[model samples]
Target: MKRAAELELALAPRAEGVTLQRWLCGELRAAILAGRLAPGCRLPSTRDFARQQAISRGTVVAVYDQLIAEGYLSGATGSGTTVAAALPIAAAGTAQPRTSAAPGIARAAAADTAGTDDAATKRPRLSRQGQLLANSPFLSREGMVLGRPFSPNQPDLGAFPHALWQRLTHQQGRGLRPDDMGYGDGAGHQPLRRAIAEHLRYSQRIDCHAGQVMILSSAQQALDLCARLLLDPGDTALVEDPGYPGAARLFELGGARVQGVPVDRLGLCTDALPTAEEARLAYVTAAHQSPLGGTLPLERRLALLAWAEAGRRIIIEDDYDGEYRFDGAPLPALKSLDRHDRVIYLGTFSKLLFPALRLAYAVVPEWLAEPFASAISLTVRHAPILPQAVLAAFIGEGHFARHLRQMRRLYGERAACFQHECATQLDGLLTVLPITTGLDATALLPRGSDDRAVAAALGAWGVEARPISFYGMGQPAPPGLVMGFSACNEAAIRRGVATMAPVLESFNAAAAGNRGQAVAGV
Candidate 1:
């Protein structure tokens, strides 16, 4: 009957990408909790379970090993894997542990299971905008968990200079004044601002002084601040279709009417932008469009500036992946071409370093600098001074530049290798899009399909590819997957693609079969 239960587990809604291992893990755990698999119950041997389920032995072994690690199962020499003899699940209304259980482990299990009861408590009311942001499917649920392979926009964290960073952080900490430890300027640490200004002026070709730079936690923070300060409750904001969701969400939260302007291969369609007097703020990633990886041409950039100047409108240029373009000379930041001081340049160290760094900056015009600084003060006051100081030193010395140079090369190589694998292994299965910038690239399905489900299936296969539809706020979006190469090594990319090939091939076969059956009936 247990063998029958294992086979039954295999049949449950697996089309949602419930892998054999995951289903078994969930089922076995549920059984143990419900007392179906009693304490000390012997689980089937890996070989036997795999035979019953018609799945690979490795999956069963993996499930067994994970359960052992999590204390839901136990294994010992000569003793087969067994349900943990004393699970820490409490009775309906009690917290007392079973007397026969291992000490400490029972309490740990009880606490883990207790979270469900806590969650079942009543929820609080949220504001209208808060509800919109929360219920939006585009919003990310990934919080604090380590990123998986092939996740988009992820940097090669393994390449970070940890020892040097630790040294810099300690050195900065040891020298902080009482003022530094206490509340500080919202604009930023003056030294870090000066360093950033100098770096941008010389490297990014953005001419600005330290006074014009306002430091924030991330580019998302910068976007939210700008929207709050600039847009009224009902002002219209122009954003790129298939653009970064965080920007659109922040603008919506500010009670602004967001219009998704269409984009093409060359990036945001400037001609399609609302006429000069209609909108106030335009959020554009000119260096590299978020999902599509297109660089707005110099002509288009000039036109955008002219449009902004004519209307006295503001442009927020998010140069997130500008430094990672694998093709052609890197173009100057949009701020570099600003003659009317209408562009607010936003940059972040998250991509350059790691996400945990929590440091980003915005370059405002001289007239708005004071107002921007005041707003930042009211918001989060300032980023944690310690990391800011460490980053400032990292840039002040040549380490930052050297790291960027090395990362550019490493990402370039990884991109090339992944592209090569796609060409050789997935030529007919997926129409790989041309990639020039960003940590991830796009690939189209041969036909319109449920990319969301496909993306979920790919995730189950240990691959990461965001559904193209996930990036769209407007209707009639394209169907594809945004596959990332930066977080993984060449071998992982290769292995992930290999795992994907059969799934895609099976879909193609089924689609063909359906068409054939239709034609025969017709």
Candidate 2:
């Protein structure tokens, strides 16, 4: 009796919007359905059941009476309530469970009911990582290859200069030395590194020699490599509270403890940085704080440098989308001002040249270059040679610079149109973030709204945008959308936002109704 009571207590649901009687009844039913509470298994007395569940005696009696009435169990004045003998049970040695099917079998059953064939039924289950990556909320509705819906972080595939890329590839390929096809330097192909160095100096005002540059697959990979080189298990790293999920996840996965420092208009609140004992690395997006679009003030930049110097902590500066500043002339990258070599500068070509390129580079300080080079050698050897050669040709031939200039002008015009449409159409319903330095656009909607549901509704309307909450580590995120406008033109931007407006209104109304219910409850 004591063992049965313990099992009942262990299986009980936590109190959440459910009466004790309702919870107990549901648990008992689930147990019976799952075959854990076998048919003919007798339930404890009402008083004992109530004691085990920490509920009133009347609640248990009510639950037992309900189950008995439902024909799931039987009871009498003296005999305890027992699972009914007629309840479904698996035949001995049968593959299927007696009552309900397992997930795989259930899915197969569902497919069969829908007339799917055996070939479809035998499909493998999606791995946890695969499922997570596939269902990432960042995916959009416009760019899916199979015409299903857009996947988030998808670049404007139509905009890629494939013809020019192929031409450049052929042009570079014709002159490739036999050794160029052989194992190259792990730091990167020299010409490509030199080209990146030159581009950074000319465009971003960051002066780094080719030796300091190391090519990696993407910004996330760069961060992961940095984490491996710099962090040890249980070491602390500071991250912006509402910052990049990729960086935060990588740091946590690398066995490093992460502290979420707050961010304001001027970027990461340096004053809020944990004490030296708490943190050894600070990851920042100073050129444009993601989702907020606020550039770190020059004063704060200097303060951060000083803090890093004093504490001997390293700064991983993710200069993602730094080239597309629409407001004013671009600010110098933090690496340009790092006389102490404490900054590991990361930049990506994904936003500019299309994400499919998978090209990004990190500028390591001279002292760390050798170890980083060795790390690269041990890991990915070097970036693919052909892309590097094509990029080098793109830079050397001046196409890259011209492309940046052209895109800047186009993005500026589209951004203006987007802002105008938001102001005109949304009016008081939405607030657009002021700065537009990056390839992305952000707008804050009213709090308490379901941004994910709103984003999904907009996707159904053929417009894709990411919910601002998707970027946050946890809840209470400000309601907003982090919209990528570079791939979309003015008309597309206006149409997308227009489509999104009704969804936003529906969310706002639902939120208001919820608030009303809460107030009435109070």
Which residue pairs overlap in candidate 2's backbone? 90-98, 139-152, 140-150, 140-151, 140-152, 141-150, 142-150, 143-150
lDDT per residue as tens, model 2, 1-522: 445445463464345566566666666665665566778787788888878767799988888888889887898776667888886432221122222312333343344435445434555678644554565433433343322222234345566677988899899889888988998888888998999999889777887999999988888888878989998888998888788877876777667888888886567887877766657789999998966778898888999999998888899999988788876767899888999999999999988787778899999999999999889889888888888888888988998888777777777876787778888888777888874676667788887667777777777787666777776764345888777666676677777778767867777778789999999999
Cα lDDT computed for each candidate against the true fold: 0.81, 0.76
| Superposition error at 495 for model 2 (Å) | 1.7
lDDT of 1 at 481: 82
Q: Which ten residues in a row have the lowest lDDT in candidate 2?
A: 90-99
Candidate 1: residue 152 lDDT (0-100)? 76
Residue clash pairs of candidate 1? none
RMSD to native, candidate 1: 13.8
